[model samples]
Target: MADEKERRHQHFLVVAYGAQSHVNPARVLAHRLARLGGADDGSILATLSVAVAAYCNMFPSLDATTDGVISYVPYSDGVDDVSLPRDIADRARRRRASSESLSGIVASFADRGQPVTCIMCTMVSPPVLDVAREHNIPLAIYWIQPATLLAIAYHYFHGYNELITSHANDPEYEVCLPGLTRPLQIRNFPSFFIDVSGTERAKAFIEVFQELFEYMDLWRPKVLVNTFEELEPNVLAEMKQHLDVFTVGPMVRSPMETQIHLFTHDNIDKESYMEWLRAHPDESVVYVSFGSLVKFSKHQIDEIVGGLRQCGRPYLLVLRRDGIEDDQSHSLVENTQSQGMVVDWCDQLEVLSHSAVGCFVSHCGWNSTIESVVSGVPIIGVPLMFDQPTNIYLAEKEWEVGIKVERNSDGVLTGKELARCIELVMGEGAEAKVIRERANVLKEIVQATSDTGGSAERSLRDFVKTIQES
Candidate 1:
């Protein structure tokens, strides 16, 4: 009976930071964990834990029991607000509250005969490690960004902080990191690396990462990256010498799978967007979105509008509700209706998979980058901050699947520049053809890793076996 019980079930908990980008990849990982042996195998169970605010946003009624496969559980961070606290005192309170709440949650699972076998956390949620240690459960980190970014962060905290700090102002200065084959320009590094401003947010980011890496050194948990060997072979090989790393990703969900949106959309008809796409010619429409977190300035918005209009292609733009002013919204829609459609939000994977979407104008968030790769759509990268620049570097410089828009002295990508990039990506030119073919080839490579008995599949199974034995 004990052996049967061991064979019948293993529970895995995935804790994610409460943002759309973080939560989406974490949820996808949970679903993949639940489907490990087969959907109905009953050998593995996966649960996703996020903050209460995010949970409420995804399920307005706050009635999420399970999303059919994986269970949904929310932990408290002291504040129930959508935005995280920026003040040091409030942030401390949130961490303490979350730590206590999550400890109780793990205990409750055990009380119900579902003791967690292993705990996996997304980036920036360091408290999960303490809880895992408290319960004596094995822990792993599900790195939701590219392997190159992970290498940069790991090296940044190790000993290269002072060197990079000294060259922060020199955007053109290149540095050769330990594992990467090519040197990266100072500008290509993550924004946090060069942000000399001692703002609370910036300082908080640095502190969190420092603590995460310190703990990683002490605990030595396995790091599961959301990239394949074929894409970042050298960096992956380099990272393995220092830490136990696993490549079980390109963790993108198929278009047929269900997706969770942590933000509410406007009352606009979502289906109308799909119907509109159907009306356009194949490989003719440009899709633009900058993910959920970026708040665009009005000047930037007007410039994007100008570029889309000048490009003269059928386009679909997803501008978040908070990104635009109410008075400007009406005129914004009126000015672009002839050649484009503006919606508050739509299904991103579904939109990318459509036959009409030829190119994606993106912020180069890791999720957006990987999804675009999976869908075989080339990119016009307008990277803003964080790991975005690094992602774009890989897309344009490393993968050659896209081009990054050039920003002016004032750090703004103007309408003219945006139009130029659109033309280069979508026009019938040799460069455009090369970019499109590379996108398709990378898509095939990523899809192959997720196939039956592929690299990602074998790595995931090995992880599960490690947990079961432990």
Candidate 2:
């Protein structure tokens, strides 16, 4: 038993693909590993490898990796200068490149004193799976999204394929999953299941998910989801039946935000936003940000701006010029800069926590979704893609803490419709009050589950124990 345990490594290697969404949560989990245990003081020797993106967030101060607080390493996917290409084949090639680089990182770590006992790789990163197999090391999945999405994906690959694919062409097609009560529409399905361009992007995404599951089955490896079981109790229990899924997340409020931002933008006025929030009345500001990736069209921005103007509330909107629809849209954002503070980006969690932030206008990305819930802010979900539609369903349908803004006949969201949705949540209506109250209740639950000795922490400890035992 002693020898077997000795063979298991003391260090952990956490490989996160470089998308801003992926890196933030991955680093937070890496910090969790260090807290769990790794070095002589009985703490963790957590080494985190972030995929280097077009805008690399790997800072200089993280170089002294041996000091025992999680060490940072960078792996390249060939698109080290600019953002990743949209071409599917190019993405595949870069993924392979990342795998090759990570292999060398593993060797270098082993040559030093510490060998990684296990690897925890984040979503859409099958390359790390290959590296684990090559080294005969165990590879565990650190699923960054909510367990609900994971379960949806599992069902998609397992038994619901024909049901989903057959109706993939139909926008209003309903899907009946065993656990979820409300039948999901084809529009409610995750992006990988529903093709957008009528092309191979969806197929490519499906292959990636398929490979992830195949690796999980082949290794029977542990899977860690970024959710607290308290919040996703049913989904967690339902997913555990199919795979060894552990809820070790709602990975928020880590100290890593100080030195690096996964996508690294410097122009935002963080202090000014906080100050603006300070000056406003409690629960009076509508905070809008679409997140790091998804870009909105001019039509969408026009409606959003028009809605905010009509709402008669103090608001903060984030609109990047690069992603704006046109000069007209950009000018609209510029015009609204004084009406409501419009910037390229701001610390989302900071903005959410402010007493002035009454409601959040979000893209409903899982990270933003969880953040809004935990922050006790009601949502106006304007989901752009991926698990967002499903998140919107959960937010508005199941959770009752959100309202989704729907598009018009021409697939454009009108200003009047957007205002009505905002009024439903942020106005003085009794229904709006109920939604805000529910959001507060959810916020308490989310906070409780991540507390010391709580569900998320305990689950993470158990995961560490399994690594030791193996």
Best by lDDT: 1
Give the Cα lDDT of each candidate: 0.88, 0.79
lDDT of 2 by residue, 252-314 (tens): 764225434644356347777777789989998889888877667887788888888887777
Each prediction's TM-score versus the true structure:
0.97, 0.92
- TM-score of candidate 1 relative to the true fold: 0.97
Clashing pairs in 1: none
Q: Among these predicted structures, which one has the highest TM-score?
A: 1
